[model samples]
Each structure stands twice: as structure tokens, then as C-alpha cells.
Target: MITSSPPFFVPMNVGHAVVTGGSIEIVGRLAGQWFLRANFTSQLARDAATSLDVIYVPRRQANLELSYEWAPGSAMTGIVTYVGDRFADAANTSLVPGYLLVGLNATWALGEGYSFQAGINNVFDVTYQESLGFPEPGRTVFMAVTKTF
Candidate 1:
């Protein structure tokens, strides 16, 4: 005779979750040709079933930018970004460290609906991982020309 037992595991949504957060931003022109923009965010996320922090939800983040207008229709800008640590799994057992990145870019208008832009990302080539076993990109450079009608 053969006998079968019940399933060992079942997947179902048994509860609900709640999330709350707030963010603030500021943008303004500084002395001379300089400009400033900045923002920050903070949040709390929890899983109802386990009463634990939500997976992959960053609790804090921020960005700041400073720019200078050197010539007519031309500007150079520097950027800084930050991300807070977060969990990679629903159980909150795996943690991914936060990271910061810096970048710089320039834009020049060529007149008559034409423009040129270039930038580099991850200026210091900092190594980071947003998830387990997956690595983020290193220093990257990009350029572009756009024509608007």
C-alpha cells in the first residue's frame, strides 16, 4: 500500500504591510554664477506577517548638486548621491551595504536648437552591490548631442 502526506509548504498572502516616509528638497541660486540643489529622504517599511523590516527597502537616501554657469548657455555640474543599507531577502537575513557615488557633467548650447553634453559616473570606481552576487558598474563616461526643433 502507498500513502501520500500533505504538502510541506504553502505560499499565500496572509497579512498586509504599512509604509511611511517623507522627503524634502531645496533648490536655489548661490553667489555669483553658482547654484545649489539638495534633497533627502527617510522611510520605514515593515512586513505585517513577520513584523520585520521590508526587504529591499532603503530607509534613508540623499543627493546634492552644485553647478556653475561659466558662459552663456553653458554650465558645469557636480553630483553626489547616497543610499542606505537594506535587506535582500524577506526574512531580513541578508544585508546589503549602502554606497555613495560622485559624478560630474557639462552642458553647452551650440545655438540654433543644438546642444552638447558629456558626463562621467562613478568617478572613483567604488565597488558596490545592490543585491547578493550582483555587482554594480564602475566608472562610466557618456556624451551626447541633441537637437531640438
Candidate 2:
């Protein structure tokens, strides 16, 4: 008989789960008012019983952002994210592919107590799923205004 630990943590369940991972993060100024930030992570989670890859845990992930501050009260930012392929089930039979996403946003201070912001997400409208049987939203745009008393 073959058995393995749960691929993911369960509520009210007690057991030993072993996972090894590492991450890298960077933040720096690019040029003038331009700045950049990035992060990357790699991990391996396995089921002790069968030594199978854990479910819902990607092996690698990354994020990057670039921004520019122009003038006194205005700025623009761009972002990118990536997730590597991994198993969807403890058996490791179900595989999820890696994906990349991009976004852009702008912000402006309108006055003493008001501000405006707008952004677009998933600029390429790439189809992908963060979980099994669930589809993430396609390209989307949003705007917001804030005021302080």
C-alpha cells in the first residue's frame, strides 16, 4: 500500500509537512525619477507518503514593476508577473502550465485633497487559471478617485 501526506494544509488538521523554498527581491532606482522592483521565488513541496509534488503550489513565481515619477504630482507604473507550472493534485497527474501577466497604471494628484488613478490589467488578455476549473479574469480596466477631508 502507498500513501502520502496531504498536498496542502487542511483546517484543524495536524501533521508534518516539509517544503523547501527561496526567494529573491530587488528594488532600485533606474534613471532619474524611474524606479524598478522585482521578486522571484522557487519552492518544492512534497508529500511525505509518496514523495509527490504538492497540489496548488507552483514551483516558481516572479514579479516585476517599473515606475516613473514625472513632474510634481504625476506618475506611471508598469508591472509583470509570472508563475511556473506545477501539479494540481497530489498524484502529480494534473499539470498546470506557467503564465505571464502585465499591467499598467497612472496616478495624478488633482489638488490639495483630491487624487485620480487608473489602470489596466492583463493587458494581453491571455487566458489562464490560478486554480483548477477556475478561470481568471481577462483584460480589465479600472479607475478610481479619492478625496480627503
Candidate 3:
């Protein structure tokens, strides 16, 4: 007769890892009053032993911003950001899906070395998670006034 035993699992630290990636960015003025800035990044992170992707490392990411200056002291801007999917565990069994976020902001020079600024982040209030069981913030609004000496 032959008997079999269930497989056992052990956790160990990785000795080394190989990560390779590149990023490209562009910034320029558009149409005199409009400005654009964009960037994109892609990367591959793998464990040397198992050749599996590293946990919490996204494969791709990007950001874009467009701003318009309507007046000498006032400007409005829109922003978009993207994060790619990534593994949440060492074995690469759990995956956190990609997410996109949008935002809008404005700034005005109040004169006398002062400025007023306001912005809204996560415009759509999309629900997403970057890590297991941890939820990120959504739909945040902020305002501030500053004076310089």
C-alpha cells in the first residue's frame, strides 16, 4: 500500500530581484494660452528564483495634465492618472486591478503676494484598491489661500 501527504508551504525572503523599465515625459505649451504635460512609465519586476512578478509593482503607469491660462493671474488645469494592475501576494495569486483618476484645479493670484487655490480630486469617486483589504480615498475637495513675504 502507498500513502501520500498534503503539500506544505513555507515563506522565505527573496535574495535578489531584477527590475527593468523606462519612462518618457513631454512638456510643452499649446496654442499660446494652453500648456500640456504628459508622461508614461512601463516596467517589469521579477523574482530571480521563481521568475514571477514582484508584489505591489505595477507594469504600467501614466499621467497627463492640461492647463489653460485665461488671464494674467488665473489658470485652470485638468489632470488624469492611471495605474496598472499588480500582484498583491508573493505567489502572484491575488491581483489588484488597474484604476484611473481625474482631477480639476484652479489658481488665482489675489495680488499683494497672495494666492487662492482650489481643487477636486477623484472626480468620479471610483472605488479601487492598491493593496489587499485597503481602500484608497475618493472624491476629495480642497482649497487653500497663501501669502508670500
**Which candidate would rank higher by TM-score, 2 or 3?**
3
Candidate 2 residue-wise lDDT, 79-142, digit = tens: 9999999776656887778899999999898999788999999999989998756789999999
TM-score of each: 0.85, 0.84, 0.84
In candidate 1, stretches whose alpha carbon ends up further than 4 angstroms from where it belongs are 1-15
Q: TM-score-based ranking, best first?
A: 1, 3, 2
Ten contiguous residues with the weakest lDDT in model 2: 8-17
Best by lDDT: 3
lDDT of 1 by residue, 28-141 (tens): 998999999999999878876667776667899999999999987789999999999987666677788999999999999999989899999999999988765599999999
Error of 1 at 28 (Å): 0.8
- Give candidate 3's root-mean-square deviation (CA, Å): 7.4
Q: Write the per-residue lDDT of candidate 3 for residues 10-42, one digit (tens) a residue.
A: 344556788899999999998989999999999
Global lDDT of each model? 0.82, 0.82, 0.85
Candidates 1 and 2, the one with greater TM-score: 1
Model 2 residue 118 lDDT score: 99
The per-candidate count of clashes, in order, stands at 0, 1, 0
